[model samples]
Target: MVRYLILRTLIFVGCLALTWLLGLRDREEQLLAVVIAAVASLVISAVVLKPFRQQASADIAERVDRRVERKREKAARSDEAVEDAELRRPAGDVDEGGSDSDFR
Candidate 1:
């Protein structure tokens, strides 16, 4: 991801520099030059950086899958702990009277 970002940034800077070198910076419509440069860079990057973008996306998806799996495992462990605790409780500890003092 970082490499892709750096590559994209470099492409944009290169386009911007090229536009500036072509006397766009001194033109009265300087914003037009910036816009043109941005569009050009975006198009070029979309084509040239396709593989990098795909790789980054795949990496992100893998990370998300791992996170979800971890969460599921943690939840399963928590449920097991609760069940174990209930199983370990004495049968005589039942609140037959349903009184608040049982908690105390």
Candidate 2:
């Protein structure tokens, strides 16, 4: 993530520098220079940074999958513990029906 951000910043700075060199900085409208530089940087970075973006996305997806897997395993273990507790209980203590007859 840090590497990607650094690379992106470099691209933006490069574009801004190029725009300034191309006489945009001499224009009366300073905002125009900034806007043009930003747009140019955005377009170039979209193409140049595709691989880094994909890698970041994949990393995030893998992390999420691992977290989900851990949660599922924890839930499964909890369910198994409940099942084990039910099995360890006395059979006579189990009530299959909601009636007072079972206690009698």
Best by lDDT: 1
Model 2 alpha-carbon drift over 4 Å, by segment: 26-28, 94-104
RMSD of each: 2.2, 3.5
The number of the candidate with the highest TM-score is 1
**Residue 25 local lDDT, model 1:** 73
10 residues in a row with least lDDT, candidate 1: 93-102
TM-score of each: 0.86, 0.82
Question: lDDT values of the candidates?
Answer: 0.90, 0.84
In order, how many clashes per candidate?
A: 0, 0
RMSD of 1: 2.2
Error of 2 at 92 (Å): 2.4
Clashing pairs in 1: none
